[model samples]
Target: MIRTRTQAFRLTLGTLSFFGATAFAQDSHLPEIQVRGPRDATIGTADSASEGAAERESFQSRPKLRPGDIVEAVPGVVATQHSGDGKANQYFLRGFNLDHGTDFAVSVDGMPVNMPTHGHGQGYADLNFLIPELVSGVRYRKGPYFAEGGDFSLAGSASLDYFSALPAPFVDITYGSNNFRRALAAGSRTVGDQTWLGAIEIEGNDGPWDVPENLKKANAVLRYSQGSPNRGFSITGMAYKSRWTSTDQVPERLIASGQLPRFGSLNPTDGGNTQRLSLSGKWFDKGPEGETTISAYAIDYQFDLFSDFTYFLNNPVNGDQFEQTDRRRVFGAQAARTMPTKFGALDGVLSFGAQWRGDRIGEVGLYNTENRERLSTVRNDKVQQDLYSVYGQQLVYFSDRLRGYAGLRGDMLRYDVQGREPVYGALNSGRGHDAIVSPKAGLAFTLTPQHELYLNAGTGFHSNDVRGATISTDPASGLPADRVPALVKGRGAEVGWRFQPNEDLTATVALWQLKLDSELVYVGDAGSTEPGRASSRRGVEATLRWKLDRAWRLELDGALSRARFRGLAPEGEGNYVDNAVERVFAAGVTYIDGPWTASLRLRYLGPRALDTQNTVRSRSTMLLNFGGRYAVNKHLTLGLDVFNIAGKKGNDIEYYYASCTGGEVVSGACNGGVNDRHVHPMEPRSARLSARWTF
Candidate 1:
């Protein structure tokens, strides 16, 4: 068996090398052409009005205390974790608490990272599998004005690209407060016109919570490629696994009554384990007048999570702990072609694309548990979901200073669900199908080389869970329920402007609004879908970047928003959308000179309403961080990172809920009644020291 495994590995490597070499040989004879006007004013796509790019230089200088922090590079986005290091981070953007990436689409190396119809929640995106050192660049776009964006992109999208080759082989070791340790080894080599890159990472951390996170994580990546990102064929393989104990949110009454510490946990057994393995490839060809690109991927993913949100909210005897399990295989492919053309007095580029994705889920289950012991099953079933999309876009230049973009996309989705046991109230075996057509348009007017204005409008949608669309009874309450449509629609519009008065400064401002047809969503915790009223949101964002000198740079970004239900509430209820953020601000300064580099950043999250009545709210939070690096020699470097510089006492997340603790009832039934505040506190001040050696 060992010999056979070795032979298979060798064959895979040989095939990758053969294709890389062929691509290199074909491009080697092409003539070099230099023709440039101004850099592409549009960021990722022609219709994108609020898009930006973060290059390797910014990645290298930023302090990434956690893997998900990398996404903070995008303006007006904030990343925070409410559970453990191994779980997905909570994201907030554009006035919405994205809830683990529900409204934002994320992709890495051309492979979609967001999971639809997940056991935990819809559009669960876990960035823990990423290795910061491997990221080459990140391009972010806010709004659904681009045809290339599909599901979970109503609010925005981010694409993370990895480097095909490293500048040099390197080993890095880091140690920090709270018994944190990490090690990484990465290298790249060129052979016969092909570049092969490999990397491995191991990390462990025991956070500040009383339960001690005890997180362990491992990641590995392998790739072979030739040529640049614009025109190259690359094959990649990745593997990641992690396990950790979580300190879930605690009730405020428990701390106020001295029943538990602020960082204490009601159920110390709460934890999770996850794993992912993927094989993916991308091929692209660029010619004088056109470009063609294709990408394909296959992934195996598994997650097992145990959580106890309400101590005795539902079951006073056994406690309210439960387990969620998901195991699935995902396959997907995309192809696109672009060609430059001209009409009577117009110049333009026409593009056409198609995408297909399918998920085969073997087991998605929810079970009642106590102290990690399963007591009964709530629901268990198998799910199969398929999505297909086709789109066409045209970018026309009426003049050197004016451009217009128009596109249309059509998506078809099918869902199939099979119940494992009827005793658990699982949805009966059934199938559901839906289709949607989205129209997009935009205009960009360049008043001069340094000033521009843009107007965009688009429609988008997010798929509903299959179980929700077919279930006749709630798994937890066992009551008659209403089924939701297979898809929910959203419409949005934006107007923005960009100005660069000189080489030292750039600024952008945008105003946007979005309306959702329905707010219905599957509540994973309750094992049912919650019907909601339609809602509307409007917001403003401003960003500025300034180069103080050759060695210093500064950035500032801010956002403000308002969200409310479109219609009046039934009786005494309010129109406010619960948990919608109202304000956000971020600022950063960096200095790079000689052999030293340093950066400092500050982030703020404003208060939010915790309930539709607007009677309760959460407090705001602010944090500051600092990072510095110094070169000791030609092949060695030393670095330090400090987080929460002010040691602020603030919560990472806050919610309003009801629960019973220690067999005591606080003005309510033993099960649950009155609402109380629940919070997850931010970590105290901490620091990490690192040393790296390169060859």
Candidate 2:
């Protein structure tokens, strides 16, 4: 295994080196595009009012503490962390917690980032490898109305694109409170008909915790490309590795009783390490016949994580610390074509696509551990999962004032599992396959050149973890286990309005609802599936953006939602869905004058029920952040960012669960662990200063 990984690394490096050397021999120049405000000008061009894009300018002036926070640019999305910076972020959108990106899809440069049947969680998306400086734009959509989206796109999706070329080469260095340090170098150059872009990043941080979350990271990207948006080909290579000590959420009672600090951890040995290497390429062509695109990718990924969420709840003497391991190789390919055609006397455009993905997991396991040392294996298995999809859509221009589209998509999933443990191996090993078909439709009416109304409806589905679909018996105990369906179905609909009264102002409002057949999900932390009730969610969202002259811009957005389980509930259990956020609001003001730029943003998260009974609720949180930058010269710039400007004392996340501290244990067992709120506190006020040199 070691030799194989080493060879793969060498091959990737050699390919990048060869491309870089070849591109340095020729020279050409291309002008760069001017980036605009926080939101893209998508009035008449948008398929739905809830879909929009954010340009590079929108990200550069924001006070973001992590790369995943870039997704927050979407109207109602929120990104927060409950563990170390190296772990995947927790996300919330449209009344869904979207734990580790389960129902929300995210991709970078056409390469999928979500991991299926992962060790930590299904659809685990870790953006720690992303270098924010290389991003060009983020295009986002809400609801399941697009035919091209598959898998985890039931709630929403976002696609991030990288700039094909940079106006100038640059280097950035930054230092902040809590021992945060970072450095990044990136550049792009055109040689003959091809362009080469490269970047490297290094960062370290010791968070303000009693355990001191020590984080170290290194990342690099290399790309070779030729052509424009209309016709082009490009290839990219990425490598990243990170390790960190985590400070997971702790029982709030401990802090209340002065037994532990708000930032203290019950187990200091909990941490994780991860590595990812990938190579991807894309080819595009446009002609009188149509426009076509083809893309393919291969990725190598590995992760090892140790966590102790319950402390001594499970094992009094050895503690509850355990480890999750995942190592896999992923391969995928996609092809699409769009063509203009005439349906009788009507003019329309037809788009069709096909996709294939396969995951070859060498080992995905759960093990009991003490002080990060493995004690005994609970379950160990190897899995192979493959997915195939095809979709087609037709957009018809019924008339100058009305346009509509209809689409159909089909997907098939197949998996094979092999248990490596001695006792549970035979009982858990199995093979399974499933298929699904979804329909999508949308209608838009142009009330005027500046106003539009839209109605969209779609069906979508997400696959369950293969282990959950094939498990016949419990690995830890000899109890029979019921298998969950390989795929869960969902339906959603939305009505929206978009108004662009003038070039300087744009506004949008949307009402949407979604229903899922079942919420049954695999619990990666426990190596088992948790049965869930069917659920429904409905929400309203609004966004407004106005340019108060060319130097100033104002943005405001908010969402209100309600989520509940369907049908009858248990006697004492209410219909409320735990942790389903009900309200979110954000506002920002940006100012740019001459060579100076500044922005201030406010974010609010409303309180929500912590359990089904609604007997206990969580506290609302609000925060303010500020950022400013000054151009020293054409080639130099300095910037400052301050987070939690109000010094708010609040939690990033809260959960109600049973856990025990050492003092609560007796005779090698926890006496019915106490059920209490566990919380991870928000970071205090802190600031960072950075300097960038452009050449």
- The local distance difference test score of model 1 is 0.78
Encode model 1's per-residue lDDT on 1-695: one tens digit a residue.
11232232232222212111101111110112101101222321234447766534555678887998899888888999888999888888887777778778888777888888788877889999999887765667788786777888888887776777677799999999999999999988876557888999999999998999999999999987776534667789999999999998888887888888988898999999999999988777766557677778999999998888777767767888899889999999888776765776665667678999999999988889988889988788899999999988777766555667788989999999888857644455678899999998888776666777899999988777778788887766778778777778889999998887675787889999988887643242352235478889999999888888999989899999898888979797788877788999999999999889999999999999888888999999999999999999989999999999999988888877676665465445564444788888988999999999998
Tell me, by lDDT, which candidate is best: 2
lDDT of each: 0.78, 0.81
Clashing pairs in 1: none
Give a tens-digit lDDT track for model 2, residues 64-96.
899998888888998998888999988889988
Residue pairs with backbone atoms closer than 3 Å in model 2 (clashes): none
